[model samples]
Target: MPQTENQTQVTDRPQATKTAILVIGGAEDKVHGKEILQTFWQCAGGTDAIIGIIPSASREPALIGERYYRIFADMGAKEIKVLDVRDRDGGRDSAYLHYVENCTGIFMTGGDQLRLCGLLADTPLMNLVVERVRAQEIALAGTSAGAAVMGHQMIAGGSSGECPNRALVDLAMGLGIIPEVLVDQHFHNRNRLARLLSAISAHSDLLGVGIDEDTCAMFDSDRNLQVLGRGTVTIVDARDISYTNQNQVHGADPISIHNLKLHVLRYGDRYNLEGHQVIASS
Candidate 1:
């Protein structure tokens, strides 16, 4: 039987001050164990978690949002509500912004990353979300398109399943939740390595994160990254890359880069952004 939205109760307790964000690669296995959603629920606030779901990125907001509402309810969320940030005006409305006060966590559903950012970026809603996250008032989780928008610089559009090419990829400003990093979802299934490699060529200072299907990378305010779920997370480290024709290259041509370090971590693996170390589980 499907759980009703009423199952969640509002909590009056003081909010916890530990900010966290979850970046899911997309197509999470919801039925078998619901591992990702369950983890998100616990991290958000467990029984006291009141999740504010934003479906603005999706073309079919209401129709697509029902799945998450029911899933969160079954997972014991104190309250779950879907928001419609379909336009710039809606994002600025004070009435809609009130949802953030009662929320312990905010979940952004997968869809078109551009649409999500386009409508909310630089708006009051996004400002509030970021403020709450930094204050540790709530945690944020997003899958697929939601995951893509988590970085400071995002891959707006690109060609996949090919050798690295700089011109074919288009980069854009993201919501900037995760600093000094770029996130790409559905990595393994989509064969996005080439594109991600090229993306790093453009922004040598950023770490390129490739997350696999049904997998996730959780980042804490301390900048510690942990891998979870059934799949893996690939890290494209360009910090040590000696050289690249990326800057000089023009048109749709193969990019040449050297000494780009790659790290592939599976479930339970951890990474420290400040220390730039991989803390693998034994």
Candidate 2:
């Protein structure tokens, strides 16, 4: 059953000063492994942090649940709860709300982003998630489909490697936990350069981040993003890309791409979103 408007009261937890949002492209187990676990350990302040997993995007609930259970366990999270947002009860169950309220960190699993958004959007659960991140200083992280839903505008639906036209692109409102930038996952593997470039061309003010698999870009409270894992995060900026025939194009028409800045960041490399500078070299 679809979620109703009113189910539970929004949480009023006090926010923390230091908060981090980790966005992973995919293949979390293969990409960072022990290091990823270690990062979570350090971010949560200990091995015994209260962690919650939202795997509503996955079609196979048992597989998704087990995958997260093992991942968190390997990361040394003692108290981990997997919230079943797909419950026929309409996502308003008291147990689900309780876990969301108390969790120190919430991780989103990769699958169908649209499914995940459908289950959480406009529900009291989503409101609590936003509140927890702002007020309680909860660390929110997502891999693949999980990563795609962090920004204000998400690529809820799009074709792979295809140059985006107005009709080819499908943008949906996201959780808005991260702002200004649009994120694309499995970037290199999927040859998503054209799609991201097209998105930047359409919205000149927004930044396009194409994250490779097995890698993560962690945005800190100070708006500094640090890259981690084996792969790279490519930042595409077409703010200066001059074009005249944007509206005349139809299917995969070539558009002039100029003044585009591309940055490939690796582990330990930090980029300042506010200043658009590479602070600490990887």
Candidate 3:
């Protein structure tokens, strides 16, 4: 028997210093202004930042890892290390774990979400990263596929350019860094609003956060999610959804959902994850 309406939520928080998690949509501005990466650099301690890059999600780990390495190096980071772990065994390598332990910031590059999880999930390295982030020992940031893996309930794959339906999206367990939400990257650019809406219709308990390209949903230690970038962040709140036919709907059948709250936020706008309140940009 499955639990439908009463799924137990994970309640865990960092009790130490303030923490920040930057979830960036795909194709961030890396050459020109570099605002998003700059913000991440500042959050991670600016010039004193000891950064670690996880390029495991990418097919060309060396290439992707070096690209970020050059980016951070050019940004005047104190130290930057690329941890290109390809297999489960690499996750346990003491050297990589040592760098992660000492790192002030960790960045996961964009690539294959499923491949990323398949390589690192439940491993000692992944567990350590989660533990450190929760303890406020490190600032975490992920782009694209990396962003998709920030939530406990992740959208692994889905079809776009369609109405909300049961088969519009595929869900998977993510890193659980932010367990109460589901993240979708390259949002509007890929026309994934319906995909996210379909996902929320099924699991109405989780907040569906859809981030547009180059944008970021920056979640602080206090659970205040702030929008930053050139585009908007769409929040789908179904906590008070009056009706949804997800349970009754089968594959590809359109689902009906009512009373769902939608918020489209831009730069400097904030949303409290704990209370589900929106704070408009001044």
Candidate 4:
């Protein structure tokens, strides 16, 4: 129970302000003490929450969608619907559009990042989701592959359990919910530190976020990220890196870099994304 003083106030905002974004690592606890998911439920307006589950990322869309529907329903949500859009056309369905319009909180399930983007990226449905999120009108949560798409520079795929190398990671475009970051989920559990380092070497301008299993990096409207759950959030900041051979290297070769900053934050810890500062847990 790594609760912060103001963590429960996540949904408290001024009129017409933005809501929080919960970026969860894969395999968050569904039973016992579900701190992360519980936090998401409360941030979504609690008993009054009207939630939509987007399971397009999973191969078994209906199965995954129903799974989350039950999770929210059990939390006493006012209404819950699964938006199982498998193709771009499904994104435009009036039925789904209505759910996107009326839902107070939206949750995207984990699966393939490419599949999620292929199905919803640039579609009218995703466009509305973005619009509502940016306007501070809705709370949004995405886990695993869903977390990977929250950045402009996405880590599509790559190897793990290796030294930092130029080719140890793959890159792609993302949904840009938090454009300044490049998110990698299942971090420490999958030994993805090198994988994330390789990613930041390519795009040093964007902060690299490594979220561990069962953990969450909750971002507020002002870009302050707070950690929650059982694991840690690793941040890689290379904005001031002095050098890198990323451009000169070719295929699986070890990369050379300097001045890359990193921070490992646990539950109750906070980091300011705008200022790149750490607010250590008290």
Candidate 5:
């Protein structure tokens, strides 16, 4: 079972980082070809891109690190690097920081989202990485657990069901790369709409996006979002929400809200991140 939240305290400080949040839902199609990764490779300068894979979130760091190593190498990534930070010390290491700082693109691999946040959050290496991204010097991407940490407010743990309730979800602070959004990966397969709605109810100002497996939701700095992959991406807009019982209710009591908007998009579809308005793109 995935841990809900770690002992690490959640803080409200906002990160000024800006970059396209290339979030892939779990189980990307990697073995057959670079269907999903090709997009990342292209954004990373194609053949000239120096890519680094961060596998610190994984339990099997070596294997997970090597997995992307082989994949990116096969796809002609200029250089592939791995930052397997096993502990906070490794995260603070100058050698590891050097590798992360030089990359054209850095990707966080899947496993435990909390594990990734715990190791890198507020570390010297993280500061460097955040600095580069804030300067628009590099691209950043992640899948699964990696994808979950890109938002300012994230869903740390929750139960998936059709019913909406306050108790169905847990919230935690995230990297804030994609500010004002709460991201949920493995969405459609897990039937996570209810929990996602519950999360938005807690903070109605933030947008909620639920990405399905093998899918990627790419966000540019202006917060323009595009969908890619074999499954649908669901958008939950609570900004216009007129009502909610999140504060008035307790426990598993059913939740009610008015004017909560939802949108389901497929590959090649586009939408605006700021307003949750669909963009007419071909």
Candidate 6:
């Protein structure tokens, strides 16, 4: 049975039977991002899987022209189709609907998530995606902006490295493929720790994951997270803590944070999300 959005939340799903969700940082292509894509393919059961590419997030749809699709074809995907959800109609095109209905694995290209959500939110196509993922018949993978939308709370930052306060950052409910954890991409490369940390600090109940560029984090059915790629994924936990006068701290305020454990995960490393602890070594 397909899990209703309200019935079994992403975080509360029985780990023994959940599907895998892949979140990739930026720079995806054959030249540099091939490994991320290849790993995703392998996890999705290889060439036999149906793959759908949603390029709707791109600023200019033409930028993701034929070359991108060719790469997936070469990788042996049974079929490949691009969903132009950026349109005013929100990828309501017949071709887009057909592809989403048949795909076993959906890949959201790195681009502007606001644009992607603006076009797809509340649309029939978006509903289908939610349905597919709930059924666990398909895997949802997104890079950059695409990756940002997997969580219930998404980071829509105005500047590259600006840390946001509770109301400063624009956050909207995401597709709900993963819950509790707020994801930020281009971590180390973009120096986004402060922003991510601030987000966690603001919402102490939520977990913060900062994935480095060219890296991928795989969260399996049981909410077990694995990190892959050349770089690292930083997990920031502020679940229990005590703080005072953060707003009053002067030049380089020395704020003390206790009970916060920071874990740097590399390729092949795994962690249990519920327990908020690492399970395997890198």
Which candidate has the highest TM-score of all? 4
On residues 11-119, what C-alpha lDDT tens digit does candidate 4 reach at each position? 4321212388999999998876677877788878889898988999899999889888888889899999898898889989899888889988899999999999989
Q: Which segments of model 3 are wrong by more than 4 Å? A: 1-18
Error of 1 at 9 (Å): 35
lDDT of 3 by residue, 158-250 (tens): 998779997889999899999999999999999999999998888899999999998889999888998777888999999999999899989
lDDT of 5 at 152: 84
State the TM-score for model 3: 0.93
Better of 3 and 6 by TM-score: 3
lDDT, candidate 4, at 62? 91
Q: Could you arrange the candidates by TM-score from highest to lowest?
A: 4, 3, 1, 5, 2, 6
lDDT of 2 at 38: 49
Would you list the C-alpha lDDT of every candidate in the order shown?
0.84, 0.73, 0.87, 0.88, 0.80, 0.72
Model 3 lDDT on a 0 to 1 scale: 0.87
Q: Of the pair 5 and 6, which is ahead by lDDT?
A: 5
Collision pairs in model 6:
15-222, 18-221
Q: How many backbone clashes does candidate 3 have?
A: 0
Q: What residue pairs are clashing in model 2?
A: 14-135, 15-135, 15-136
- Give the better candidate number (1 or 4) by TM-score: 4
Better of 1 and 6 by lDDT: 1
The segments of candidate 6 whose C-alpha lies over 4 angstroms from its true place after superposition are 1-18, 160-168, 244-258
How many clashes show up per model? Answer: 1, 3, 0, 1, 0, 2
Q: How should the candidates be ordered by lDDT, best one leading? A: 4, 3, 1, 5, 2, 6
Per-residue error for 16 in candidate 4, Å, reads 16
**TM-score of model 5 (CA atoms):** 0.90
Task: State in Å the error of residue 121, model 2.
Answer: 1.5
